[model samples]
Target chain A: MKDVSEMYIPTYDDVLEAHERIAPYIHRTPVLTSSYFNELTGAELFFKCENFQKAGAFKVRGASNAVFGLSEEDAAKGVCTHSSGNHALSLSYAAGRRGIPCNVVMPRTAPEAKKAAVRGYGGIITECEPSTTSREEVFAEVQAKTGGDFVHPYNDPRVIAGQGTCSREFMEQTGGVDMMVAPIGGGGMISGTCLTLSNIAPEVQIIASEPEQADDAYRSFKAGHIIADDAPETIADGLKVPLKERTWHFVSNYVSDILTASEQEIIDAMKLTWQRMKIVMEPSCAVPLATILKNKEKFAGKRVGVIVTGGNVDLDKLPWMLN
Target chain B: MKDVSEMYIPTYDDVLEAHERIAPYIHRTPVLTSSYFNELTGAELFFKCENFQKAGAFKVRGASNAVFGLSEEDAAKGVCTHSSGNHALSLSYAAGRRGIPCNVVMPRTAPEAKKAAVRGYGGIITECEPSTTSREEVFAEVQAKTGGDFVHPYNDPRVIAGQGTCSREFMEQTGGVDMMVAPIGGGGMISGTCLTLSNIAPEVQIIASEPEQADDAYRSFKAGHIIADDAPETIADGLKVPLKERTWHFVSNYVSDILTASEQEIIDAMKLTWQRMKIVMEPSCAVPLATILKNKEKFAGKRVGVIVTGGNVDLDKLPWMLN
Candidate 1:
């Protein structure tokens, strides 16, 4: 096994550079402190609301940093990616700002709203079957056809560095947090968070929250092995991806623990955010709150930070968990 | 009418002082810019999202300033008000912070969600019949019983001064927008907006948007007389109040126009905000957007600022709005 510390981990300087690169392109989403949520869970919770971030998710931070970091000639060549939702929107928005053409390979089963948002931001979409085989096959065909540079959603070092920028901002906004929890989906956000926290505030415990149904990261972290699954079923559609080689190394080394929450808990937290905070959060974004609610004893009376990943849920399809 | 130009209009300096007075007690709600809205309206639209403000409305800005500006002895005596919804929640939250009791006289027809929010913030509710006579009668009885100071929702000079803080923040963020529009209920928001714009950005046009069914402000502004109706029908529950004396003087002098939008237009804008901006806004908050959409020619290609007043709509009641 490769020594995890030797793996590609972003330094504080790298994150600072990424922040500077994306400063003009992306919004520094505010950290909203919820006294209502604190009273309910007995923890001082600072919700890093990336739901209000540009392109409606933290994905924009990484996508903007990567696209802007590219040379003018390379950017003119354009960018390509395969994503079911938020990543596609971010890449499309980032590319739109630079007037670069973006092609996204999205699963046919992806929500219409997600597809509309991607196209709305000027990304050309090609529908593929809902499997790894189909995504890679379709992406390769599109890459060959368009000659666009492929941007991996999570595995790329640049993308990880970009994701670290969110944590850097989080720490700056909130002087120093004792613990930070973020939802693990494709391991992109968590990997960046881990890398950034490891350098800036090594004492701050970094915890990963995953949907129990899609517990590949939790299982992999526990067993100290790369766990790849053909398919996973969870309402957190973003977390369906198993950890890739680059992300797996960072998670194993820097993440203190990976906690799992039930699908019902995710839905409940989503409803709670909507009702109490009046913020429309998607199910995947609610995983951190779900983990905190389920394991209150672990976080009681502590200044804990939770990343609310996104707010792209369809109004017509709110989860039945509230009822 | 007593030389409107010489009327007591709050200065930018006064707004600055109010901001400082209420800074600790009030939230600095984020200013959300919508590219989608800009594309749709052909205007660079900045939504001063008071929906995300504390107590879910801009009322908290005024309520906090009013309550906190009181002497320590006066604060200890508590505060009372008669409001259909938002002001009640704002007063409750502000009073709760001071550890003082609040008595809210509300119509029995008030929404359950609002009532629950008021109670959640530790407010005492006094239910009254849904009429001006009943509301006044009940409020007088409550004031006589509790000896609490009456923090008039929109009529009080302190309340109007409090609302001015929003425009002060807006001017600082956007730096001299071409036009500013806010919904007109009893004109607390617009009155404050006009005062702030008059002092800071004197060249900016101040427009007031009102629901057609509740166009008392429009009528009154045109005829140069107070228009008081026994009852008005509108889904914009927030705009039911007739113009008060202090607000009337400001609106009469500083407001460029009072535009009216149909209930359907307001509902459409509400839906569009939810679908496109991913922000929850009530009918009253949507009035400005609705007016802009309905009269596109007037606002087209201009830098427009809209105050999204609040987001306290009941989720269950939304499906019925489609009808």
Candidate 2:
């Protein structure tokens, strides 16, 4: 495999390779539909349910691809990443599948449940300050000490290629759709979606949904360049990160539009889904549906594919129950 | 079709007919598995997800069968039932599918979410007191006034036959299981499981799970006769009803044992499932898992089929949130 650090953009071919390589480690999650939402929006919505994926998120696809795609020499050093959320859990899961050591650098402030999950997957954790700079500095030291290959959460070509497999599966499962909507955080899921759909179903529009509280990606799309957010807050904790260079390539080139949803809209959509669709999805995953609901005229009567990115929410602290 | 009010016991042939009748109206829900639970309990568990079924519960299977099997004359008059739960929503959904009126006699104290769902499906609600005596009295009056076909939630032969279809699908989906566990209330799902498994796979042991607070079924199983509780209470609201004569016929004869879980145990299991399996299921549905976790020795290393009965929970009132 080419060096993931080289800034090499992944193609459809790389996605095909990722799909084949990660087949044994990840699940091809089910596609679900909701009649209530369909009637309310006048759009036929098909939800690609990655929440039910292994490790309770779609990041497993990228993590599995990164871990298993490693050459024997690289694999021996094991894999390491810096994440306090699903990526941390997912990378650990992937490493466990291969029976290799996985090191994670997490902020000390991360939720205990998430830390426990990382440890549950046999990941060795090195705690860092909650700041991005501190996390990066700590993660570098861990990688230097262990010689573990770095797996950037979304910026790596391998991860993007792996994420593309989801849209491939979505297209195959649903035949086709007029538009595809996904929530953008660091833009790994959206970039992967862009790569796959642009190569195969270029006619389909790709819409990136973002939380208005953390609208850096939205601002970047309009500004036509990569924009960085030092710190932003939202109920959609997963979507607080800024877009990087690799993701911005696809977002600027292939994504048809970027949409934003308010914090209340995200929470409302999340609760409504749990009540009506009877599925547990995170607030970040609800951004797509929230945007669609807010801009119904754009999606009404169209076949829309919604990527429900993950289902890793703290059960005791649901957003609706917090009031 | 045989008269539902005649206390007729349905057979495998009736189950087959019911399956065919409801095929067009109901969803053949997917069976889900969790490696975490498998490792914890040492049992190979297959969760038959009726929580994802049409109208968000397995009750839809019975409701669909009753609504579709009625003769043109009977169907024209519509159908009625008294339930403050999934059955009310299910019958309403089934009737809506058939373009027929459905009258639900629900307790006024039923959560507004459930009431709204019933109305959303075109069910006309006739409110009554929370007590069963008042429910029955009001239901009788409504039936007399509308001349609607009375569809008992669990006791009717047609309903049992319909519910039996779930096990048929479960067996087909999982090949077969060593033990099948389902939560017991009026024992509709358990009775149906008994009818199906006993006819086709009698070797598979049927276990009924009940809440400790609403332990009438557990007590009745030990006493070798029906035991009615005047007003039992539990977080598993769907399981407060005692076994009716029609349901007891199968429960007593076919079920190998009855299990019960305390309210706290049920809540813990429910929260664990949402966190780990990432599925939105109601407290009533958690009884099987609660009992399985409680009695690990009974199910260790065996292929166990779990019925996740429903997912129509109030988002604002999660049991764990009540301090």
Candidate 3:
């Protein structure tokens, strides 16, 4: 992996460029509000619904940016990534829209639904063991043979710029929010939030929500340094990744606070979201709402923008149904 | 109960008045479109999402109309209904808005989620045996003791007129649709659709969807008479009730055809809606999509309006997960 200083840190100009480049491929997902949740939280919440994004996640925003930003030659060579979640499918979706190949390195044991999504988006999958080392090793061999352009999921500049556009749209849709909350995994979304809000509305508090089981970004934020676990177990399966250097830069700078929610809380909030809001979102996406419920006093009477990051969930394996 | 001949069938004027009366209480729900489903069915489908309605169903339109249209003297005694589903919760939700007592006689075997929703909406629940005779007997006793104004779930003209407003909004939202499809239970929504479309857009075809297991409307439409079933079992519990004389008038007069889908097909369509559209809607609501898929030749290349009737599904008891 490249050193932290070697990474291309994106700027607001890059976000504007990325938005223009990806305008055709991505969806300007709707902003939804619920009076019931508003009454419960005592805060007027506007949910930036990236769950309805192209590949069922905000990852599509960054993926599309990366795909569209590539030159004709690099695009012809194709794009590659190692992820078992939304990014893998999103990258494929983006690459397919550009009529390019997207090679993905995923664990052999990844959920069938996710694999189907990747395949449906025309991604070529190379199965590896469900370990970081195996993923890296397999991705290296695949990348060497395919000679594809590498797009690091959360650590790349183009991806961050792409994800930042979601907040831009949120502001435009809601006439600007007082504060924003988003789930922090590898910190791509949070970093993008910071990147966008820090420029346009720096006064807005940028809060990050994390699963207690996989609270590396939260711990890192508190420690003023990056701290990643080997593999944390959580129902918020998308949030197992550790924060990379590029994402860490923004999270360490503009993020006001990092909050964590328990696995049960995440599940309950996910169910409540479906039951009351009539929208289907993943467990990882509910982290922000779970945190709000935990820290109700902090957000009371504020117009809060909650980024619902994704909706790629295994309907058959919903957490509430499991024994 | 009012006799079939004496019961007033709602007209377009009543629908126009109902729209004005219930405008404050009901939501003019957003019209959603899916390019994916459009490609699959070869029909440009517009979804009127009533799942996001005040109490999570289109029934709220009728319930609110009934409650709000009542005189101060009649409304003072409160409203009562015998339903184990959306209508019960919708009545409670409407009653809560007016701070009036809403008595709901629900079946003892109703799902816990429905029961909780009724309670959440501030309905007074009185349980009865899971039989029409017992429901009528218990509701009669409750009505006699409380002397509450009876609001028949679908048979009442006010409720039918209220549901008609959704179609009016649909035309306004989409300019106009070539055809409209909705699930037919007691034919309230379908009747409402007929009432509005028959007057405003006489050329638009109105279609009724039904579960094959409970295809009384489909059978009756072809037979040119109303057929009442004692009990019919389907995963779409909301579509079990047969059409009343009041609704039958509109269904028989205006509906072009009544289509039906098997239980498994309904379940598959419901899951597909959740998986692809990323929206939580009940099995009953999937009937329209199922019929669209089955009769694609008929609707191909047409702009079809699909009324997503409700979103009140038991999260734990999803049909795909059942044994």
Q: lDDT of each prediction vs. the true structure?
A: 0.86, 0.92, 0.91
- Stronger candidate by DockQ (1 vs 2): 2
Show model 3 residue runs off by greater than 4 Å.
A1-5, B1-5
Please report the candidate that would top TM-score against the real structure.
3
Q: After superposition, how far is residue A254 of candidate 1 from its true place, in Å?
A: 0.9
Off by over 4 Å in 1: A1-20, A65-78, A137-147, A320-323, B1-21, B69-77, B129-134, B144-147, B199-201, B275-278, B300-303, B319-321
Superposed Cα deviation of residue B197, candidate 1 (Å): 3.7
Q: Write the per-residue lDDT of candidate 1 for residues A36-93, one digit (tens) a residue.
A: 7899889999989888888888899888877887888878889999986899999999
Q: Give lDDT tens digits, candidate 3, residues A1-323.
A: 11223667889988889899899988999999999999999999999998888889999999998898888997999999998589999999999999999999988877778899999999999999876678889999999999998987888988899999999999899998888999998989998999999998888999999999999998888888999887678888888889988899999889999999999999999999999989999999999999999999999999999999989889989999897
Q: What is the lDDT of candidate 3?
A: 0.91
Candidate 2: tens digits of C-alpha lDDT, residues A27-93: 8899999888999999999999999999889999999999998988889889999875889999999
Q: Model 3, chain B: what is the TM-score?
A: 0.97
Model 2 chain B lowest lDDT segment of ten: B1-10
Give the candidates in order of lDDT, highest first: 2, 3, 1
Considering only N, C-alpha and C atoms within 3 Å, which residue pairs clash in candidate 3? Answer: none
Judged by lDDT relative to the true structure, which candidate is superior, 1 or 3? 3
The RMSD (Cα, Å) of candidate 2 is 1.7
Q: Name the lDDT value of residue A2 in candidate 2.
A: 76
Tell me which of candidates 1 and 3 scores higher on TM-score: 3
lDDT of 3 by residue, B130-159 (tens): 767788899999999999989888988888
